[model samples]
Target: MRARTWRRIPPAARRLLAAASAVAAMALLAACGSDGDSASGGTAAVEPVTVGLASGGSRQDGSWTQAWYEGSQTAQAELGDTVKVTFVDETNSVDAYDKSAASFLSGGGDTWIFATAEVPQLVDKFAKQFPDSMVCGVEAPRESYAANICTLLPRFEQGTFLAGFLAGSMSETGHVGVVGAFDFPILTAELEGFVLGARYANPDIKISRTYIQSFSDPAKGRAAALAQMSQGADILFSGVDQATQGIYQAARTAPGTYVIPQYFDSWEQAPDVVLTSVIYNLQGVSQEMIRLAASGELANQHYEFDLKNDGVGKLAPFHELDSQVSDDVKSRLAEVEAQVISGEILVPGPDVLGTTGAGSKLDLATIKAE
Candidate 1:
């Protein structure tokens, strides 16, 4: 998704707002001690810690980056006075990431990190350079570091499945569309789950899939969505971030066509057209990580959150289309959710250039029978 250009708010005004928000956040964090046990029965001493955040994009983009910001805010609220977040904006280069990490470390940040798998080398370099500082890389594994670095990834397939169910149930044309940022394993997992879910709900469901090759191109996303709709797709599910707003806009022109948003609830963008959202709860995960850090038990490992962990999942807020969804459909969806969380329903593993990854291939026949 090409990032939407903001009407330049004077740089001074922007800086002032950022400073003010940071001050307010710091105050809030100060009031909340690092008490992890208060929420989950893990009593630990409250400590004042300073953490830094690095983003590949702006916090206002309403996408993956915003989700990370939300998580930082939650950590600030729950950890009080111990957290400070500084984001690197429009990070499109490795040099930028390296500089951001170095700056954060030099500035005394207890934890310096970047979100996304695109900056593997930068993350690895920083992990080695600042071994004392905790480092977090979101959405991919930290292949080199073992002690001071950890990776956080979401079970995005879980949410995609729910979105597929919505599309399959609501699609009038029997065709649903998916817009992806890239053709990577992660994106493929989302597409696979969505296709599987749609097929599970309706055997004859047809899926139209496309990759924009970039995560910041709104025009591309909009055009792809329009093309799919033109080809008879009635529901659009996007794995791209801000570009999804373009998809929502495209759906509006089609009246009854619906869209499923990524990262956060986008119903406000098109109340009549947006079916529901497959949201990521980064705030919850960030808070948990901060608590673990405070307890000195933070480990370098891949942490995957799913419907079962309340880490990543779906939200079908009752909207204009609520009445159209049958009671039996809702009940069946609930059953599907339970089965997925309990491991009874397995989403297919990622396919590499059309080949399935490790794990038993999903039995499509059995899934549809359920």
Candidate 2:
């Protein structure tokens, strides 16, 4: 939901209020609720917890931010009054993100969830400043053990690789494309996995990759997608946020073109042209974090969701495009997925993919482009 009020209060005041809130929450532990019998063999009420969620784009972007927002909503629905989630959207800059944090702290928020890849460093800084608050950064470049800080990373590369395999098998032009929001390390790793999987499917496949430098700029995203299409790319992967709208529009104009979106299952957005989606189990991860915090088990550590756990990235079902894929392709995809889960085909992670910078780390020159 929209965080309407931004109260800029002094740090001392905020800390005092936070402490007061904690004490008040502790007092609520005694409230009786009609749930199943607990380990104490009596009725027990869930602990009251307030979570602050911040994202770099609109919460309804239908991609990265939307996925996390939906996750938080899922947790809120399941936990009922025991958990409260307040959120700020469009935090695309350092100042905006810090201001959102201050707003959350002023409101006595006990937990902080930064749902964008651009704000991990900011989350680290906030964690250091507010040692009492539990802060988490999703998709951090690497794991950290700092006090009061937790990082959640999903093996998104797995799904992207699978998406690439599908694109490779379906591309009649032998050329596919990828449009990313930024050249961040995590996204680079995902796109690289896509390229690798495409190559695996068709050794001579042409893959064109580009970044629009923003998660919300639809015009730029559209232009980038059109450029790739001009070069004969008939299948495209969208790694941006709301900008996916533009990519979908471009796909619609090109009759044979199709798209694969990440983070959310977006087939309905463009049912005709959408092949499948790379789904990151953000709902499960978000709920787990809330549960951990509520149970007082949250600690400074890294939580990774991946294929091995069946808790992270996986491909969505091919909706209307199901009939377009051959049975052999589907069979091969299944075999490849099993190999990936079995560790036989290891997808390179962020460590090998390189970090965020001005441009992508992948060597576009290494692969021939038509």
**Highest TM-score scorer:** 2
How well does model 1 score by local distance difference test? 0.72
lDDT of each: 0.72, 0.78
Tens-place lDDT digits, model 2, residues 1-370 = 2223214666787789889999888767644431323344433565478888887777887777777778788888887887787868788897898899987976667889887667777877888788889888866444338778888878887778778888888789999998987787788878877877777688688878888988778899899999999999999988887788899899889898998888888999889988899888877777787777766788888877888785466889988988898999999999978877877777666666544321233443342223
Alpha-carbon shift of residue 145 in model 2 (angstroms) = 1.9
Taking all chains together, the TM-score of candidate 2 against the true structure is: 0.80
Q: Summarize candidate 1's per-residue lDDT along 1-370 as a digit string, tens digits.
A: 2222323667787789779999999987865753433444334554456666666777877767777778777777776765555656667566878877788887667776577656756666777787788888765443455687787767777778877876787678999988887766666777777877887778788778878877777888889999999999988888887777678778878888888877777777778877888876765666666666655566777776777876477665757778767798788888887788787876643432122221123556655325
Show model 1 residue runs off by greater than 4 Å: 1-47, 140-145, 348-362, 365-370
